[model samples]
Target: MALQARALYDFQSENVGEISVREDEVLTVYSEHDIEGWLEGVNSRGERGLFPASYVQILRAAAGGGAAGEPPASRYANVPSVPPPQPQVAAAGGGGGPGVGSTFCPPPHHLQAAGGGGGGGGGGLVQLTALQHQASGSGGDDDDWDDDWDDNSTVADEPLSGSGSGGGGGMRFSPELDGPGRYRVSTGAGGGRAGAAAASSSAAASSSSSSKSTATVSRNLNRFSTFVKSGGEAFILGEAAGFVKDGDRICVVGGPHGPEWQEDPYPFSCSIDEPTKQTKFKGIKSYISYRLVPSHTQSPVNRRYKHFDWLYGRLVEKFPVISVPHIPEKQATGRFEEDFISKRKKGLILWMNHMTSHPVLARCDAFQHFLTCNDEKAWKQGKRKAERDDMVGGNFFLTLSTPPTPLDLQEVESRVDGFKGFTKRMDESVFQLSHTANEFARKQMVGFKKEYQKVGTSFRLLSQAFEMDQQVFSVGLNRAIAFTGDAYDAIGELFAEQPKQDIDPIVDLLALYQGHLTNFPDIIHVQKGALTKVKESQRHVEEGKMEPQQADGVRERCDTISFATLAEIHHFHTIRVSDFKTQMQHFLQQQIQFYQKVTQKLEEALQKYDGV
Candidate 1:
């Protein structure tokens, strides 16, 4: 009987003498090739060539009586000519191949035997038999099976010594091989190496190669590998020569003298209003669009919530150290409801106010684009430009002009630590305040309004009872009682309306600051991480592992992060002070007006009873 094997993976011929084989194709094995990882074979088409031995599983070994052109008994000694194991479906987590489970359901076409249609349909679980050894003279230098197989391919019942490479002297097999043996094969999308039993008999055959393969996979999977692989240009370092332009405005490094701002030459504010329902793709999709009119341009632009969201992301990416306030949250269902729309509109208005007031944020190219670009093409161009900006992250610090004198490193660290502590406490307080104020607003809208209405109802009932009396003296008292009832009803309306003017605005302001507070800690961590690197470099210099000049370069890079962080901290404090003062003043004024209205209504009701 002729020795035959089934191709477990598709093999494209890299060399002229090698034949290409599709996955699941069967080929007749002529003899073991002179090469270490290859085999001489004839495919279904009768085209003779050499193919990788690792890509196929042995279907049948040559008969005991040696025939001409057959591989010697030493190579096929362990490979029995028993019938192929029946296909079995096992659960996915059963111990088996590297990254693949023990059982695999081959496609219907794969289950069909070579020469004729085999039994069983697609998705039938199949247990692959032992893999053949790789021959060296395969005509293709790239046909290294040791590189494809993983080290974790141990048989569940019988453990194998070597990683899944078949380069040892002879084939190895379990003592009780007649049963349903635990053999693993690659069921990956394209094709992979076989399991533990396929490894070389010699334990040390491919140990070094296996380690290299494992390390390559681990390095590729790392999250920071992209930045490392890109030569540190992904975030764009400021020191990266030729990337920074001369005219770019660099942020001034903050020190004991305090932070300085790059004043906006053309300061302006923007108004967001006129929310209207919008549709696209012939109304298949609908959303709300808000009208934005900036004071600088006076050119109104329409934007949806998603546009604002996109701009917010760009701002955060460009200014990692700066606290970019979050926009209103997205809603999936009931988004078109009147109440939700109104609430979201208020949030966007508050968000825009902050964006316009901050000198740095106001001058941001992305913000300007969002506010001023009315043309669709111009808006898209501006968006893409902002996204592709190189001056971001640590590179953003490179854009800053430090003080003429070097900052005291100790003082800078102390100041940063203090600010980090302050942000934590401030965030906690603001969160508590926001929750309390929100709860109070809810009470004013429901609880307080109900209480006032209840009082008015009782007074009106008393007035109605008094009206039933026909005495002349009671008439004046009755009219006064009715007036008092009306006054109470008016007071109830004020109670319901008060929150929107005072408490609600206060809550919105606190919420915005809450977002800023959360962002500060991350910014501080980035600076601290840079500082740690500088210390490590110094230590390396002391140990003779690094040069003094190299340590100085590390310190210089550390300064960039520190400068940006300190400047951002100073800017945050300034904005916080101004914002609180304005909001408190407005809140007090609203409170006074609300109570005054209530007092006047009560006095008018009192005058109706003057005679009585």
Candidate 2:
């Protein structure tokens, strides 16, 4: 069959610059130079349990730093030398930075003392540094380092050429020898025992307790050199057990300090019991049912966790409960270092949010709210089930054949004004929508006239309205409650209508309200604080420390922040909670009303029939 070639966008790369090519070109697409982006559409469309290849590709692209391509050279003109690549800057290593000291090791003791003497002592075990690991088996960096070549008598696995001067780098392997005798070297291309005499010569053979000489030892090691690299850490279970339950035996391996179960040597297995299971599952996979079985060995649970191996194993009750723990911090270790602790706390926060987000949790919470408030259930179970079914059946994991074009792709020349007017506008639009709303507010606020004379006036009025009727505005609290009551409906609307192109920013804003409003009194409180700050800055102008119109600048700043915060809070309520409630409530009310009217009509018809 003739192969049909296809064209696809090299979205998986960064270096190629945006271009189109035949499908075969993609076969050569390396991890480098691929377009990176969050394939939201693909993820949203695909089933949860089994992500499609396209979904994986999109995720890889997203992880590779998504669509924010390298800035145009002109954009960097005002700034000095091109900012070092992010990873390189991180690699250069510093006291504290995202990727600084990412090498697997423990920091100085003093740094450790600051964090809390020790949380988990083994977490401090250092593994091979990144550079050290990369250097091994790659001929140790220098292209021409052959210290072992001086001894021509030395036999290698490679076939020899000409009278034992057989050293030239190529396919190297050892020929099995038999019997005990010193054999002469054959420099033939097929450097095996060519003649029966050579075969019977029994060279490179050894007696049981012979204490093999240097040459013989080298030959023996080389002959048996079977390189087996340890695969990256992962979980493996022996049997297809049912949901992993507490007290079930399980093993863990491949972590920075050591495997959590730390008993399995390279290629070993063990069972998990209760106490250990409790430790492993704490905040880790609490949402999932699982138990970490006790390990009889103190080493890693997997025997395959040989030297330099990293993995984590746990006895999980179910497949979904298993999780890989990773803390993002400089020089992270199992120890309770400050950064590690901070990250751990952050991880806990994230986990809590995740658990609360579970459908089961949501249903329970919705039920609780309805029972407490004597209101209808906020979430519609049947509708939610349908949505889940659709998600499971439909493919959200479609891979895009093309990638988006960056703003810099068109410009070839270097100049101060390299960017066109529309390009600038478009770039500005990419700035998060909330930021744009804030900018809009700054322009309108009257107090911002001196500071942001260009701002619009509508924003200023909103801020003014907020300040004057704040107590009354407090009534918005009930609206918020109502909105929260209808969260599922709101989420559905947002999920269905959210702009596909720039949804992350919107999603982020929505999340803040879904989780954080309890921390703040109300959106109005945020606005009032901004107003106070603006007034303070205006006081500075009155004191002659600043220009008379500087007060306008402060006001503008206040107006923008206030407006953005309000808009975001309201938008979040509208999308994540209110819409859902409103929709579901309307639906239920309509059904109830319809049934009532139908019963009334039927009764009247029966009466009329009786009279007849």
lDDT value, candidate 1, whole model? 0.58
TM-score for model 2? 0.17
Q: Which 10 residues in a row give candidate 1 its minimum summed lDDT?
A: 166-175
Model 2 residue 504 lDDT score: 26
Residue 447 of model 1, lDDT score: 89
For residues 1-612, write the lDDT of model 2, one tens digit per residue: 111112222223222122223222322111221111111111121211111112222113433454444422322122222322211000111122111121122221111111111121111111111001121111211222233212234222322111111111111011111111111111111111121111122224212112211111000111111110110000000000011111111222233421122221222223322112112324442111112211223332211111001111110101111121221122323433444443333333332332233222222222122112211221223212222221010010000001111112112111112222332443344355446534544443323333322122333344455555557645454333333323323333332322221332232333333333332233233334435544554565555543322234234333333323333333333334643454356546655664455455445434433322
Q: What lDDT would each prediction earn against the true structure?
A: 0.58, 0.24
Q: Give Cα distance to truth, residue 35, candidate 2, Å.
A: 43
In TM-score terms, candidate 1 sits at 0.61
Q: Please provide TM-scores, in order, for all candidate models, with all chains considered together.
A: 0.61, 0.17
